[model samples]
Target: MKPLALPSGSRWSAAHLCGLSVVLVPTCFLAVLFIWPVLRLLALGFGDEAGPFHSYLRVFTVPAYREAILTTFEIAIAVTVLSVMLAYPVAYLMATVSPRMARLIGIGVLLPFWTSALVRTTAWIMLLERYGILNSVLMRAHLIRHPVAFVYNMSGVLIGMSHVLMPFVVFPLYTAFRGLDRNLVQAAMLLGAGPLTLCRKIFIPLTAPGALAGANIVFMSALGYYITPALMGGPAQTMVSQLISFNVSEQLDWGMAGALSGVMLVLTLAAFFLCRGVLEKRLKRRVVTAARPYGEGLSGRSGAGWGMVIAGCAVMVFLLAPIVIVFPMSVSASPILMFPPHGLSFRWYHELLSRPQWAGAFFNSLKVALIAVPVATVLGTLAAIGLARMKGTFAQILEGLFILPMVVPAIILAVGLYYQLTPLGLTRGYWGLGLGQAVIAMPFVFLTVQATLRGFSRDLELAAMSLGAGWFSVMGRIVLPALMPAIVSGAIFAFITSFDDVILALFLTDVRARTLSRLIYENVLQDVSPTITAVAVLVIVLTLGLLLSSLLFQREKS
Candidate 1:
């Protein structure tokens, strides 16, 4: 018996239908939750009663709004510069160290990176406030006559924002360093180049693009940042995100909020596109040099002077200080935060456990993560698979569309979703928040699965199908098994994204429905409590565990 073949047109139609089926859910999900809300936001901004562009005109003409916009730019640029300056030394250290030592240093960098931004900001507050740990230590040692004002100022804002954003610079610069040609460096040294000269002539030139790329990310992220500045900076340091939040929540001015979000959205997308261009060029250059394995012909140690090592180590200490300080602070018997923490006790831990709000919020976060992660995983995995099968300009466009949630600011999404969902009463439950989180989480899953698919062999599927296996059989037996590790890693990331979310919870959940992060934010805003220290430590531990699990899956995949 022979198998009957369908006509070419019929086969094309079937394939097209299959493609649509795969992408349908994710596309609709993004459209309703993300695109529609954004569109509505823009509509509100433009359709203001005063005039067609009244909101936008107000953004530029109004003194307070104008200053806020200028302040946002100034802070973003400052943070970008600070992040790049601090990150270079750390990146250089990571690139030059032994693999084991590098991994240890990586943990220090990632502990803060993976930890909630809110937690980090809180930790900084405890460290830098008047009579806080750092000031206390300084006064005890007679380094100062008084407790200096370390927070609630521009200095505090810069420190907090820079610490959080620096990791963006570090990773990219590290990659660039790893990709540097060791032979070129050795040759330059043999020709009597000193460390400083070698750095100026070769290292700086080669790594500048990566640093700039990271700077762009830092700047773009800093532009929309809310938690750090709102908590750490004073009125003078007010950013656009805070302004948008204030307009929406305090002033009940949706038009102004929408306008601010539009400007932020435009700037973020522009920066994202520019960064993509640089990265694409950098990747192309890397491919051209693929004959040599990265870090090839390089010694474990470089000609880095003691000064470079000290700078690198200092940066590492700076990165880990807030995290390290929180542990002892959490255990302090004293009510006030201080270095060495007087006597050791776990009263804060006890207090945290005793609070119903803490426990309720913890479980609420879990509930949302449980809902978001699975939905994100399934939709992202399907989207990845469908996208992999697709070709031409449409697929390219669709790929960009899929990534918009990540590129757009969280505040914009939070505000927009609140607007779109309030009318339908969807904002009243965990369901809406969970779905909102899924919008952000889906990109991580999509990118991970899509990367895995790039290395997958389609011939295996073809062979199975040619042997009379169905599509489901091929996917179940071959594709899914190959993609499992990536799927798991993606899910872990999705969970983290949902668990650490405060912005979404702020708008999406009322008091009863608040998550752990939202509760922490409230505590920070209302008053500093010893219980928050304990909570921060717990959050750090949980985030670390999730990150490590993701790393293991990545290792398995590799």
Candidate 2:
């Protein structure tokens, strides 16, 4: 749809002013709540008493800090490479398979993707620990005399991070694959081009931009990752995020924390822009070279080779392994985490409810989501509507500002808010944390609603207005109902974002008001219990339910 045009003179002025007002609500909300605190935090790093660059100089000079920064880039690069490589076979399979099989394959990728990171990490620990299920099975098979070390090492760190991040690459590659011309592949095959030659000459070049885009995202996200490395990695594998957390929680060093945050923020932005530039150039080149002639007698579909099919199946198993393992383990009667159950029982489920701390944390998560989701939805919807009506560089700038919360690392936001609110005593309850989560959740809602509005018909609103209806009446009776599917989709995303967050909860709320994710993280650090497995199962179920609900809404909209 084209941009909405307005009437001349005072009418245009009125409409323009109205759009500005609608945009201002979310702008001011983010400005005061998100942008101010982060700026304050960054300023702390540069304004130290010793000198402007004192904290930064120390970050480079200190051996522990220097090694952490290097290790962070190293792990991020490794995870990026692994994710891109593992994504290709699965993406290819999805694009080539029947629709039903593709949906099944998608569920395998997305079920774990949608679930909480903490839960997946916990499941990995159970499967890969020294005396864990994998080792036990291998020993029983006489494959090895003793358990292989998996968790609490570099190997464990790579596995956990790659599993968590590979979906970032898969979806993009799937899109790129689906857009490929089947005629090109069939023509090459008719010329007796083998699978390896076809892939190297045609498929790889066509998909390179998408792969690079995915790699960029994985690398940036990995830079800010805290939970996986903290739980799975040994001391030598520590990343910059852990250092920032340590300075704030353990060392009482705000300046150092701020300096580390600054470094991460710079690196993340640099990677984003650099990758974006490369992708744009690649897209332009593809467009210029995309004038391929259609091949006659090429109706037959190209299928993945046996090797590709086997690799794709293996990747599907890897994606589903953690989620699948948690179910049987949750029902195990044994206090220890064993694969085959001593007996099937709901004892862990009972423990989950009977414990006061567990019950309280669950309810706290609900209360915070209740407060955050609606606020994010309202602010995001209004921002989308206002932005859709707008045209110019000013609107583009505002859009960027609106999305900055998502681009900036969550740890930075958490620490900034912690520094800003701790002094005002606002960190004592769920309200502050709810608002902090709203900052992160709003961007998802904005992006979803904005895309929906692009396809929405403004003619209905104009028709309603022409019939003597007021703006409020038109929006309430006409616009919102039409946008309900998108609204619900955005709300689900916002709900999950708020519900699954741990970083903000760690810093913004104390023990008395902690969230479930935070409590799970703490418990995993202290002990690996059967009850945690039960909780993981529940979280997975909840996430899949929400995902299904979103899909249902989209189908209904169609």
Judged by lDDT, which candidate is best? 2
Tens digit per residue, CA lDDT, model 2, 238-335: 99999999999999998999999999999998998899899998888785333332222223444556567679899989889888899999999998
**Candidate 1 — which residues are off by over 4 angstroms?**
1-20, 278-304, 553-558
Q: 1-558 in candidate 1: lDDT tens per residue?
A: 975556775634445556667888999999999999988987788879889799999999999999998999999999999999999889878877778888888878877887898989999999999978889889999999999999999999999999998998998899888878777777787999988898899888788778978888798888899999889999999999999999999999998999999988998888888888987787677542434423554444554655667899999999999988898889999887767888999999999999898999999999888889999999999999888877667778879988888778899999999998888887777988999999999999999999989999889988998899998998899999999999998898899889988999999998888999999999899888888999999998898888888887678777
Clashes of 1: 0
Give TM-scores for every candidate, taking all chains together and pairing residue i with residue i.
Answer: 0.94, 0.94
lDDT (Cα, 0-100) at 121 in candidate 2: 95
Q: Report the CA-based lDDT of candidate 2 relative to the real structure.
A: 0.89
Regions more than 4 Å wrong, model 2: 1-17, 288-304
| lDDT of prediction 1 | 0.87
Candidate 2 at 390: error in angstroms? 1.8
Query: What pairs collide in candidate 1?
Result: none
Residue 414's C-alpha lDDT in candidate 2?
94
The models' CA-based lDDT, in order, is 0.87, 0.89
